[model samples]
Structures are given as C-alpha cells and as structure tokens.
Target: MTTMTTDARFREFKMPDVGEGLTEAEILKWYVQPGDTVTDGQVVCEVETAKAAVELPIPYDGVVHELRFPEGTTVDVGQVIISVDVAPGSAPAEAPAEAAAPAAAPAAPAEETAAEPEGRQPVLVGYGVSQSSTKRRARKEAPGVPAQESGAPAGTYYASPAAAAVQAELNGQAPAEPEAPSARPLAKPPVRKLAKDLGVDLATVTPSGPDGIITREDVHAAVAPAPAAAPVSRETTPAAQAPVQAAPVAAGARETRIPVKGVRKATAAAMVGSAFTAPHVTEFVTVDVTRTMKLVEELKSGKDMQGLRVNPLLLIAKALLVAIKRNPDVNAAWDEAAQEIVLKHYVNLGIAAATPRGLIVPNIKDAHDKTLPELASALGELVSTAREGKTTPAAMQGGTVTITNVGVFGVDTGTPILNPGESAILAVGAIKLQPWVHKGKVKPRQVMTLALSFDHRLVDGELGSKVLADIAAVLEQPKRLITWA
Candidate 1:
C-alpha cells in the first residue's frame, strides 16, 4: 500500500474557529499566494463569520507552499487551508517517524481505517497534524449507470454528468443517461434558499461550481427572463403581418440580487427570533426637550465636556441609565431554559448603530459607573468603531438594555424591535422645533418623541411605563439628572 508523506520542512495551517463555537468562515480574500514569503504574525487572509469580518494571521515564518481553497469558499474549522515551507534555504529535513508510519506499517482492513483510525490526534487551534488519509477516493466505473448510483459514497463530489458519460463509453459500456428525477441536487444551504425564494428549480439549473454543485449564479441564470418573442399581427398589409423581433434585454437592467451572509444574515435571524420568541409591547411619549437641547449646546462649550462627543444622544443615554437605576427590574433578561427572570445589577448599555454590513448593537460595558464625560467618550468610540465595521463579537454581548437613535435619520418615531437577550429598546425621534403651549402661552419649543419597546414577559406594563416616564421627565427638565442621581 502506498501512502503520501510530506517533507518535514512543510507546515500546514488550518482554518481556526475565530469566534466562540463558530464552525465555519468564508475566505473573503487572500493577501499572499503560493511562493510568497511570510513572517510570524502577518495577516495572510480575511474571513467572514456569522458575527463579523476578521483578519487571520499566520503563526510561523515560511515560504508559501500551497493554498488548498480559493477565495469565496466556505471552509470548516480544523481544515487544512494553506501550507508553507519553514526551512526554505536548507535541504529537506527528515520526516518524523509518525508521519512516515502509514507507509511502513502493514495495510489494515478498509473498514477499520475508514471508520476511525487509531491514535488520531485532536485538532485544536495552532496545533495538530494534518490528516493525509482523508483525500478524495477514486471513482469506480459502472456500465450504463451514473457513478453516484454505482456504489459511490453519499455526498461524493463528481466532475460532471457529461464527463461521467464519456468515461463510461471509453470503458466499453453504454453512456450513462441523465440523472434520475429522484436524485437530489447538490447545492449549499444558502444557495438552495435563494433558489427557493426566487421560485427556481435547482434540478433544472446547470451546475457551474466545482464537483457538479449548483451555485447562486447558475440559479439566477436559470430564472432570468428570456427576451420577449417577436409579436406578429394579423393584418391585410404585408408589413403589418411580418413579425418584428425585440432587442435583447440587458443584464441587471431590471433587477439585482445580493447574497446575504456574515453579519447581515446573523442579524436577520436574530431579529426574527427576538420578534417571535418574546411578546413585545411598545409605549410612545412626546416631550418638550428645550432644556435638554440647550444643555447639550452648553456642554459642547463647557470645559468638562470639551474634546468629547457632546450631543443629545449623550444625554439621552444618560437619562436611560438613570431610569434603569430607578426601575432596576427593567434591567433584566428572561431565562427561558431556567424559567426564571435574572435581574442585572450593572448596565451594559447597547447603542444600535446602522453600518453598511447591517445593523449592529455594540454596548458600553458597565455604563452605570461611568461619569458624564466618560460616557461621552465611550459613546464616541463605540459609534466610530461600529461605523468602521471593526466591532468585535465580544463588544456586542451581555447588553441589558439598548437605545436606537432613529432621530438621526429624520424619522418621527418607530416601534423598534428588541435585540436578542435584551429586555428593552428605546427609540429617539427627531428633535424638531414646534409650537407648544408653555406657561399658559403658545410658543416655539424643541420637542422630541420617544418610543420604548420591552419584553412583556419580564417587564410588566407598570414597570415599563415607569422607566419610560423617568426618561421623558429627565429630558424635559435637565436639572432632574443631577437630582435623580
């Protein structure tokens, strides 16, 4: 039995689980290709997981030997993706005994080795040997039958139906016919979902991906409307009777399709789960924020708030924090599995920021302990990081309550959805100047609308109303912030 062995100078790098328990990541781009030299801690590629986009760095120095997969391919964790030659200038080093043992040892039964090999090492980050025996198996020839149905293993990747048919004829057998209707097509889950959404049949679409797998492009091509046939008129004149052909439709002129993955996909799933799993109740209140608006301008010119992001959001976030302090029950989460309500003592304030990738809520850790200036600084950093798309997954976890500034977009107000695991979300509308009745007289004053959405299971109507009222009260009279604290 022949076994494959690699030179000791060659080292393989496997795709790592970047986030906690993330099983796969899509290779977005590669910075270096084969034959390029690399050093330790150099970013070799960027991958997008369900959480966010992240760059991966190589651990050791070497000359690139090979790249197993191309860009845009989704790779599972613990799969060998790239190899490098560590000792480039030196002669080939001696292969380790264990690396060469498969070739020297007696051949074991096929069932024994296929099921599970003895002494296999556990694959972990930055450690473990690449398994050499897991290469693709050879295809077996069968007369007048497709390779997949002729004892090939389930989920085996095939070249193409045409290639299989040609090979069957060369082997002195009749060419294989088209795959049966009952045969399942090979496509990724996301591609299948896309096809289903567009009402396209995957079986009829041609396969352009490697190993006879259908791709998003192939499905789109199958569903794209054909140019309209020429219209013929029944008339006495010859010119009217003749048919006239229409010009072919240009690609992407009528519609465009975008494949959803990574952050956008995760956000959609989370919003659906949060909306369906928890019973949501929304409360709205319109308040005069003339004092809060004036306070924001004053703080912008004040010495204490200088060089910080001083705006209405700063005070609005502060108001919510103080409100949560008063109504501590609002700062809690429902433990579905435990069937209990876990009340939190500290606040991790979530700020819902809209980014190009999607909407992400990155919260300030332990926001209750922060002073006014410190809170302003944290808000500035969080907004900047999210807009730059550099927010990490850890920055988004453990948020007890959230605030979304829909006011920035000029919207009047909206009933915002709760972020998963959070108890409530506060929406702030545009602060517009309007005529209002104040001091028994009508006058122009700055007014804003606020909407609060909460999970009804943990927060009763009385508790939710109290939290929202406290926020509105603080915004209307700015001095309440100092007194309430």
Candidate 2:
C-alpha cells in the first residue's frame, strides 16, 4: 500500500482581462462577507477597470475563508481576490465550527469568544478569483429539467431574467409577476452605471463561472436584441408628446448624483491633479490644411494601405509620433520629486476615446516603433474593444502620452486636459470644407483645428507650439511627414 500525505490545496483565481485587453483592474465592491458561505459560481465581488464593471464569481463551493481588499482599492491583473475553505457541503446549514467552538473550550473564559475567528484570510481585490479548489457542485434537478445542469445554481431560476429584461426593452413584456424574485443585480454604484451605458439589463443576465452570479456578459446577452424599435414611437400619447417632461423629485429620491468609477472617475481625479498642479497654458493655431485632406483621400485608395482606415485620425497619430521623435523634450514629463525632466525612450501612446463605459484612454505600447499597418490594426482593435466596454486596466495604464478625437463630434476646438502622470494630450478637431484664403485668396478647402494640452511645467509655449506645428504641418502637407521621419 502506498502512503498518502494530507495537504491543504489552493486555487489562485487571477484577475482575468475581462474586456478591451485590460492590464489592471480596480476593486469596486465586495458582496460576500468574509466567513460567509459562498456557492460555486457565486458573485463574491464587483470590479471596474477602464471598460466595464463585472461581477466576479466564486469558482468553488466552499466556506468564505478570507477577503483581501476593501471596497475601493485598485489591484493589478492576476491578483487573488478571495479565499474559500470549502466545506464538504454548502456552508454547513449553520456555522457548525462556531457552534461547536464553545463545547471544545468549556473551561476557557467567555472573553475569548470575542475572537470568534473574524479576521480570517480575505479574498483579493480586482476580481474574486481567489484561493480555491475549483471542485464543482453536483446537480440537484431531475435530468429532464434542463435548468439543473450545473449542480444547484447559486440562486433560483425562472424564464431567464436576461431574456425577460431584453424582452422588456421591446416595450411589451408582461410585468414581472409578484411571485418572481427580482432579476435586478446586487451590484454597487460603479457596476450600475456600467450596465446602464451598455444598454444591459442587470436583472436577467445569468451568472456563470461564479456563485450563480450574473455577469456583464449575462446583461449583454439579455440585450442582444429582439429587434430595433421604430425610429418614431407609434405608441406616443398626447401627454407623452409634451414639449418637455417634468423631472421627478419625490421624497426618498435621488437626483443629479455622479458616481466616481472606472474611466470617468479616474479621469476626474487625474485631470484635477494635473489641472491644479501642472500650471496649464493652452494655445491654439488654425491652419488651412487643404493638401492634407487631399492626401487622406489619396492614401485611402492606395494599394499599400489596403483595408486600412486612412482617416484624419490615422494621419494625426502618425504625425504626433513623428513630432515626438524630432522634439523629445515635448514627449517628456516633469518629475518634481526628482526635480528632473523624465524623457521617455519609449512611447506608450494613449488614445482618449468616448465609449459606452464613458471616456477611456487605451494606449498602444511602443507606438513609435509600430508600422502603419500595425498601428491601423491596433487602432481598429482599440475602438472595437472600447465599444464592447471591455478595455482592461492594463491597457489604460502606463500611457506616456495621449490623443483625443474631438473632431468626430464636429467640433472646431477646445483646450484638452493632460492625463495624470503624463506630459501631454492632443485633441483632434473636425476637418471641414470652410472657405479660407489660400495663398491670400479666399477659396473653399478642408481645414481643421489642433488643440495640444501639455504640462506647462515640462513643455513650455515654445516646445508645445513646435509640437503642434509639426503635427499640423504634416497634416497640411503629407510629404513633410516622410521627410520629417
């Protein structure tokens, strides 16, 4: 007979890149109190990175052993979130260990009862992928009932809540029956906002991979679309067609409250710090780049550029890279503590985009080294990922510089804010066919405005102007970009 050794096993659930190829995530909230029994696939916590808010599930059926973080701490990817001691069955109908504790120590003083094992190891933040043994629960349903496929689902199920919610969006689902448990999520403030923006209904989305917890994906699947509502509502009544609806402000109601979460919250804090400390000095210059528009059209048709989006933004990104190469100082930052200008040898170029999750800045690492095609692919991927509200914290972090495409909104220009810890943010305004003096003669041509918001402490008016001029010059004459490179 072979001798067997007894050992405590562990499951380290890493914070996964939930969406937009994230690198890091922030702990938004913890739902499962430590020492509470958690079901396999139960939602133990909620997390928000740059893209979206997700409810992370407990992957094992066990006793809640520990919680590693507080409600609002930021954590890196692959960090442990929670720990489970795993009882043979669901957290023994009652905490047998606690109840049996007094008997084991009848001689001990009652004061020691205060120690009641409250400070056990905690689950980690960012996501509830923690110390566990990934063992599954055995199903409880008759084989004929399809709902019982995964042991006992963390909670009861009815006509899939997500399906019901999406059907509600279609303007004609029977109201939820009084007997049914609400499909609403138990998410915190940040998660609620994320769901709202994605058009996802929290109530119906099924939770998998966690304690019967609904995830952002569950919401997505719920809103996946029954069909588009008509552009004009045919069911409008005379009261509904009033010039404006009154804002309801009844007792026990909330109004005009903004949540500090995800990209919006991060951006707010960063912008505030940058604004107060950096001594911002914004200057603007309008150039008639008729030739730049011509080149944009030319490149769109080029065989070499095949399947690429050869637009003003592409040219602007390329131009910024070129300018940074020429003027390294403008690409650098002010390190007040070191009292030195930190000139980055590499450029992790950030692109500030407006997504369903609010405004996000997802950057391309080593963008200065990427080719045109590579840059194109990166841009496409970033936009698509942001649209899905899946950008991770990793992608949003470590950005040396950034650019914002305000032009897509048909705006002429405005002063942009610098991302915290970074030296500059470039705002690309709309290109319009405005009549202007070409060589001193009024004529119609495509023109755009470029707003470069840089850290005045690092980049002075001279450096900022030169950088803007370089980018504008490239847009004005594409040939200058080749030679400037």
Candidate 3:
C-alpha cells in the first residue's frame, strides 16, 4: 500500500447544558492549565452555574489544547470550554480499536453540542429547562495552545486558593504553619447558625481551626445541648443571646457583634421560603431497624463493596425509593396554575446536602432506576461534590422527591421543607439503640425516626402517612425488600 496519512481529528470539550435553560455560567476556576496530561474523568475546571458551583470532570483524557474563556468570565451553556488534540495514531476515548487499548487512550471528548431548544423557561416561577444541544460549539479549536509546560503548579489556569494549598501538600514542600497571632477569630456558617440558635455572640469565642476558624465543636462546648424531652422549637428566632467573643488580655471589659450575613443570611431566606410557601406537614414514625443495620454491616464487609461507606444512610435511601414506588403520589408534583397533579414516571432524587456556602440539594437523575450499588456511588459523589462547593445547579433540579439524612448530624427527627418544585421530602433521622416492644415484651433495639413533610394541598394525611409507614416498614424488616423488590 502507498503512504497513507492518519491525521487525528481533534475534539473539543463543550460546556454541557446542565439542565434548566441556564443560558450561561461563570468560569469560577480551571483545574488544569494548558499542556497538562489529563486522563478521562479527571476534573479540569469548576464552573458556577446559576445555582451552585460544580467541578467539571474531563470526559476525555489528552493534552489540554486551549482555554477559550478567562476565569470569572460568564460563558453561555453549549459553548466551547476547552479542547484536546488527539495524537496521530492514538485511539480516542471509547474508541473501538484494539490497538489503542495497548497505550493511554485519547481524552473522552464531551458531546460537542447540547440539542436543547434555544430559549425555554421553567414551568414554575423560576428558570426554564434546555431540550437541545448547540452544534456550533463543537468545531472551534485552538492550535499550538500551550497545554501544560513541565510540572506546572496545580490549577494554573484558575489559580484558586485551595489549589495552591494542595500543590504545596502534594510536592512535599508545605510552608511552615504561620504563627497565629490575633487573639480574635472568625466563625464558620454552621458555627454561626449555632450561635444564632443559642443566642451566643461568635465574636467573643476564640477560633481554633486554621485562620482563627470557629468550629461546631467550639460552639457546642460553649453552650449546653438542647434538652431531649423538650420538643425542637420551630420558631423563626431562637432568642436574643449574646455572641461570645474574646476576653481581654489584661483585666478589662469586652463586647463584640458579627453580621448575620453569608451563610446565616442565605439560610434564613431559604428556610423561610421553603417553610411558608410549601405549607409543610411533618409526620413521624418510630421503627425498629435492627435487621437493616445488620444488613448494612454485612454490605460493608462484603468483598465487592469493601471500600464504600455502606452505612444506615445507604439503606435509608433505598427505603425512600421503595416508598416512592409504592405510593407514586409521594413522587408527584402540584401544578397550581391548571390546578392538577403531575405524576412523574421517573425520580430525580434530591438529598439535602449542607455545605459551607448554604444548603444545596444535588439530586440523582432517574434515581428510582439505579441499583443499590449505583445509588451508593451516586450518593457518595453528590456528598463529596457538595462539601467541596462544586455541586452544579443542573444537578439540583427536576427533583420529584427528596431525602434529607438529618441523622448524619445526630438529629433524631425534624420536619423538612418541600424543595421549590417537589411536594414531598423525607427526613431520615439518626438510628440509635433504644428500648422497644417485641413479642409483647420490652427490648433494646436499633431504632430510627422517619419524618416526611408533604404539601397538604395535594398529598392528604392518609397518603403521606402511608408513604412514611412504607419506608419505616422496609427498614424495620430488611427482608421485605427481597419480596417487595
């Protein structure tokens, strides 16, 4: 055969239409710089959508060719975010060639265009949803772009604060911890919430974490825990308590005040909106989940799932899915305009994730269809991404039902508010050893509380009660899943 040229077709990474017709998103930061060797599935940048910031993992692995937009620049969805040049003779991501499997495959290029309708608004009072991809986004490419020049610092393109610290730690050249002067301190969001709840001024308390950070432990140590017998008060304000801050170095008087902005400010707005507009009706049921806990332990020790956090939370998520299948109404939404119920065939499961920024509910798409292992992995990724402040707005929408694991914080039970669109939210409370009745005798058993809050307008007391009961019953006897499943 005569000479044949095999020039590789370059692929570009387009900004995916994350869900709602989010016209544009700001490039918060880029994780990789030009010329860095990236593999498929590696996170390259963190983009802030309309709702929250999310880490955009690279779908393809190759040398990054170009960055089209600068940090803090707002880029429309379905635009070219980055590009990777596949070397000639290299196999592409998911390429069907047998020879390409021998070496590192080219990066998995994301779908170039999102075929969403140009401009669609959300049915509710908020944003719209995207139904198509943009074709023009796929062709633009930057040739001879400096992908990565030899051992560049982490996040060279974005230059985020956290990336710097990670670079130091990774290279075994971490700088010496600074001599923390300033006897004063700064409080985090949750600590600030604790201060507001207990009427404690945060300015006075000395911060113990890095950069004089106030922690939840600091707040708890400063005040007493809520009394177990007294019910959790649902009042807007806890009380007018003083924020504790620095005591004087010399014998002196002291006073301080912290503005309730940032987390506290945003949280107040969300809680009020969810609580009032949703008309929450909380119902509780106590169940003995001893078998559920046992099954969890078995799964944890199982050979296949040796490394996952297979805890009670995993089982609770499954129980909620079962309930949704049993009582389909629990997974439905209310259409106020037409005055009708919109029953959904799929479940975009929302797990209320509390983060430093605020509360974000990064949901699972078609959650009802996922297997237990898949659900576990999805939950794991969602929680990890949320805590890192990388959950995207698109991942947080079209949720038909929700599950809030309050027990993760040792909370027994509380009525959760309905997410703006969905009608019902299930709160899986802490599971603890408690005394219970079995075979007409009292015994100590593993117990948990199932709290479900529903919109009274659509979901009546009976339907709500049945859904909650169904989840509780599944947990009470784990074997039922084998039959019901």
Candidate 1 lDDT over 1-485, as tens digits, reads 21223554456677766655577888989999989988766888888878766677775666888888899988987677777765455444244423433354565456533632454333323333223333223232233433332222211112134334544465667876746423556654445645775678888998997556676568758875322111221111111111233446677688545677878799999999999999999999999999999999999899977667678888999999999989999999999999999999889899887765667787876789888887887777676666555666656777899998888767889999999999999999998999999999999999999999999999999999999999999999989899998
Better of 1 and 2 by TM-score: 1
Candidate 1 Cα deviation (angstroms), residue 83:
2.2
Q: TM-score per candidate, in order?
A: 0.69, 0.57, 0.53
Query: Against the unseen true structure, what C-alpha lDDT does each candidate score?
Result: 0.71, 0.60, 0.61
Q: Residue 338 CA error for candidate 2 (Å)?
A: 1.9
Tell me the tens digit of each residue's lDDT in model 3 across 146-170.
1121111111121112222323444
**Which stretches of model 3 miss by more than 4 angstroms?**
1-50, 55-271
Top model number, lDDT: 1
Query: Which whole-number lDDT from 0 to 100 does residue 295 have in model 2?
Result: 80
Instruction: For model 1, state the Cα shift of residue 200 in Å.
Output: 54
**Model 1 superposed RMSD (Cα):** 20.5
The alpha-carbon deviation from the true structure for residue 369 of candidate 2, after best TM-score superposition, in angstroms, is 0.4
Model 3 CA lDDT for position 259: 44
Give the candidate order by descending TM-score.
1, 2, 3
